[model samples]
Target: MGEENLAAVLHAAEDLRLEKWPLPEPKENEVLVRMARVGICGSDVHFLKHGRIGDFVVKKPMVIGHESSGVVVRCGKAVTSLKPGDKVALEPGVPCRHCSYCKEGIYNVCPKVSFFACPPTSGTMARYFCHPEDFCFKLPDNVSLEEGALLEPLAVGVHSCRRGGVGLGSKVLVIGAGPIGLVTLLTAKAMGAATVILTDVVEQRLEVAKKIGADGTLLTGKLNEEEIVKQIWNLFGGDGPDVALDCSGTEPGQRLAFLAPKPRGVAVMVGVGPPEIKAPLLSACLREVDIKTIFRYCNDYPAALAMLASGKVNVKQLITHNYKLEEALQAFQTARSGVGNPIKIMVHCSQ
Candidate 1:
């Protein structure tokens, strides 16, 4: 409860430091949280290594994590939803309610949103932080603090599955076995997809996918677009999948997702990729395949929490490594090198 608390700041590219800083106070509608765990997302690593992610450049020193959970230590006067000792997951983005996007129920795309770890917003890679009480969803007793932190990414998976229209007897193909990809696979399976095929370049990741209940795993190493298409078709018995999701964001992965769907099937691009991508659009146009894109997530936290609380999704298997706040540099290094079979690396802020 002291004023000084530890925080991980990205001072410069590949230069992360853990230092003592003043704990922030909550505003009238905010709550002060004692951070429990913070998940190291790919965006975090990108910012640590390059000091920027696309247009959001770190012109000033910024805290490093967004997918996180914490215990509420203090609540503002107007905060009636949460109180002290409540364990909750921070949604990370706060959008202006007056905006058209917010009014239209798509706050994730709000232009006036202030998201954690993005440009000017300081993130939750610290001992204590403050956020809007509404953005903090209380976790049930069955869900651990670590699982609370994972809800952020799991929300994305839920959104992707919803967009892809996954349901009973749905045959789903998930490209990429990274954190988001694995989460998507789990979400699709939980939504009643009979078959889920996961593809990744790393054998270890694919192995993890299988362990996590993926019906099949494919290793696509330097395979051309045609070869990848053939492999996917063969996996689905030469009929193509009911739904294909591109969670890798690579050109090849996106192309494969677009081409792996049967006529009238859906292809959802859930991965983050370059602005301009080259693909075979004519094939998709002729097949009448529907294309959809996801941006973060919307109205998915409640579903993610319900799934976790009900044991419908096993997210614990995705956490492969853990480190203290002081070991942030090593965590970033390990994530960047990809030398080990790391799936989701967590930074323990409370430790």
Candidate 2:
């Protein structure tokens, strides 16, 4: 490999450029990886278009990818878990080990966590980047690099289902048929949920969801909130689902998360929506629905990997587009434009 490390750099809103980034060196606890597959996330498109996601604003140039898989190129002296030539999926966030939250094993909320592609921190979109050894999960022989790249989003699904207490025979409702929602549906089914219903405004996405394993799908574009809720309730035989996972993060989706769950059931917010919204909080409170939220993920990577390796969850069909590292701008444009209704756009970072 050469020292010329090319990357898709985001300068500001609508300002993405291909440039040669500095080749990073691994610290004792880190390993250098030659990136193979990088998936473009919705957050990547959001940051490129708006230069911000809530309070985290892109004030300077930064590499712009997070969902990625790579081959280990070099390992630092003290890195014992991984070795050169190993294929691994990169978990973007690395939290401070000393944080109280990290001590409690919920490092996703560590205040000083440095997550890839989140404003100031550089991401794994480049040809080569360094990541902490502990944060990278080695891929099994059965998992392709593409599937490994997808594990990042799959981890979110695993975490969301776990938070929602999806288990054997648990009925689950997922709001939105986006990437996250689809993965959540897959996870819930793999976790032995008896019924998993997904809702989305896009019929195409719902079609995809049905193909993947959603027991039922509702197209909610033409329906009002109340009607949609009633229809969702009907799906579970005149009763709300055991758990409602909101992956749309829209006001309607969040409200449904609260309203469409059985009494004393769980509602987990998996999407990043607007900072504030008018929700049916009192109604949910009165019904005793337990509201919860997931930041990124905590200790869920192994489950995601196991599911993929065991053929329990298939994410291959969700990848609708592919581009080379040089065509990253076009990839981002295609993703943003929704040309062909692409579910996942994968970028090959290695030449």
Give each model a TM-score: 0.98, 0.98
Tens digit of lDDT per residue, candidate 1, span 158-268? 999999999999999999999999999999999999999999988888988898899998899888778888888899888899999999989888988889999999999
| RMSD (CA, Å), each prediction | 1.1, 0.9
- Number of backbone collisions per candidate: 0, 0
Model 1 lDDT-worst window of ten: 1-10
Clashes, model 2 = 0
lDDT of 2 at 260: 94
| Candidate 2 deviant stretches above 4 angstroms | none
- lDDT per residue, candidate 2, 1-351, as tens digits? 756999999999999999999999999999999999999999999999999998899999999999999999999999999999999999999999897999999999999999999979988889999999999999988999999999999999999999988999999999999999999999999999999999999999999999998899999999998999899999999999999999997988999999999899999999998889899999899889999999889999999999999999998879999999999999999999999899999999984
